[model samples]
Target: LGNVRGKDWRIQTNVYGNGSTTRGREERYLVPFDPTEEPHRYSILWTPDYIIFYIDDVPIREVVRSDAMGGDFPSKPMSVYATIWDGSSWATSYGRIKINYKYAPYVSEFSDLVLRGCRVGPIQQVDSADRCAEAVEELMSADYALLTPRKRAAMRRFRERYTIYSFCYDQHRYGNVTFPDCDYVSSEHSRFGEWGDNKFPPKEVRRARRRSRKPSAVDDQPSK
Candidate 1:
């Protein structure tokens, strides 16, 4: 989802696996100033084990394929797609602002395209598909692979300062069922308020979190 002049790009992952859809795996980022007026490199690295986002080679976010997720994680092959259209209902300030038709033609630009992956055979066996994707993972995730400790620190700083919305922290909205990947093992997880969702942190841990040195909260809702 997107908002005009709102200074955020709510990138979401519609993880479809085995003909089913998994929701709420999303993030929001405060990109470089006036990116639309200029050009920025927005890159997504999808591997068999994780999903990583980068803006000009700086790691912004990471989502691991946890064992707890079962088939809910996106492990299938998909195409690269981009679209530009009107989202008056749920894109601008949670439907507050909308597209102004006076600016008739809004253009989304693209250049320096790079596509690298393998071509799996149709209806390939499960084991065969897994083997093929593993090889492709080495290529696709080479430069944009796992997050280093330093990069993770930088990411935490970014989210704490600029992230306006997040799903992992909203216990009141999502209730008891939270994804396993939400609980990062560091302070970066604090940006979500409750790193482990409602069911986590036990009683003692909850008290510890309440007395945390740097607290975070579910600051804002999504556009939808």
Candidate 2:
């Protein structure tokens, strides 16, 4: 199957053959035989250099032109698979088509597939993983300003690659009630309010005090 963007593609073999061959010219074969009638296995092996298509331990096709793919080759490791597809094309040259509606719904069975020389490894280093987990825990437990530089860098890298797993801080949820987004309160202000005494005046309060001291009410009093 090919992605709609004409990239990230795969090919499958089944009855009604609906499979593609890239030798000389690209040819697609249709198979209509129901493999489910008698069990069979299908597998695909993908490596850094090539993709091998197999049928019951027999190698049928080998896709070896990774360089021709420019940068679209499947470089990352992948697992093997076996899947069935309903025949929706011309029947194979072999007599495998279901002629009547009684057998209209054909089923293909895939089993006993093997992945040769497959290996699994952690996506990131153990230290990086711990750092990422710790960063998240700290963000959840403390204020954003308390986040250390190392933690912040780790968080940034985690977010850039795996955005869904990144941590977020809800400044509005610091206390029991949600604060208005328009409020200009900084993290330091919030921290002081929560931990320190609520004696330090805010910028707005200071400005109000200065304005109150001005002679505004009697500025227009005529030479009393």
Whole-model alpha-carbon lDDT for candidate 1: 0.56
Structural similarity to truth (TM-score) of each candidate = 0.70, 0.30
Residue-by-residue lDDT tens digits, candidate 2, 69-185? 434444443434445453334222112432344544645444454444434455632234453455435433433223344433433332222111100122222334322211233
**What shift in Å separates residue 82 of candidate 1 from its native position after superposition?**
1.1
Error of 2 at 180 (Å): 59
Candidate 2 global Cα RMSD: 30.0
Question: lDDT by residue for model 1 over 1-224, one digit each (tens)?
Answer: 55464333343333445557435554554443344445667777777777776665666667778889888777766667788878777545556887788976867889999876666556753446665766776765574575666567666554555454556666555766767877544564553554323222122322322333121122222222
Worst 10 residues of 2 by lDDT: 159-168
Residue 61, candidate 2: C-alpha displacement in angstroms:
1.9
Candidate 1 deviant stretches above 4 angstroms? 1-19, 121-127, 130-134, 184-224
- CA RMSD for every model? 10.2, 30.0
- Residue 189 in candidate 1, Cα distance off native in Å: 8.0
